[model samples]
Target: MFAIAVRFDLHDTAAAERFDELVALTVPGIRAEEPGTLVYTPHQVRDEPLARLFYEVYRDEQAHAAHEARPATAAFLEQVRGLTRQLRVELLADLPS
Candidate 1:
């Protein structure tokens, strides 16, 4: 398995709304529609209103790449571009189970 982790900071006031939108709308759609997506989880830090994290898992690198190429992902990115502040993405190798 491969993992894709992303961390970002959003505007404090928009944090809750953004997290809600992602969980209620974005995450479900991605998990159901993207075949390569094994898992998609988004989280927000309780103490830091602006902090957000995304933990995604896929079968492999090819699967991960395909997920990134999906139209829904593109649309989501476009929709959230303005809502996010600082973004950082990291590709990781999953440890043996």
Candidate 2:
């Protein structure tokens, strides 16, 4: 599996609101259309009202590439750039079990 975590520091309350709206619009597509998207979850940050985080897992690198290739994913990335003051993306590596 391939995993990634994204942190969004939204510009303000308005940006956060817009970001949430975008998420609502975008996730349904991800859920319905993305078979290789094993898990995709968004979270509101504790004590940071303007912060949002996303956890995403894919079946493999090809799956992740397919997700990125989607038009909705492109649109989501474009819209979120305006809302976010800072965006941090981490490519996660698994630890030995």
Candidate topping TM-score: 2
Q: Model 1, 1-97: lDDT tens per residue?
A: 7898898778667665875575578788787787878888888777887788889898888998888788877887777777778889998875789
Q: Local distance difference test, per candidate?
A: 0.79, 0.96
Query: What local lDDT does model 1 show for residue 16?
Result: 54
Would you estimate the TM-scores of all the predictions? Answer: 0.83, 0.97
* lDDT, model 1: 0.79
Candidate 1 residue pairs in backbone clash: none
Give lDDT tens digits, candidate 2, residues 11-88.
Answer: 999999999999999998898899999999999999999999999999999999999999889989998898888989
Give residue 82's lDDT in candidate 1 (0 to 100): 77
Q: Per-residue lDDT for 76 in model 2? A: 94
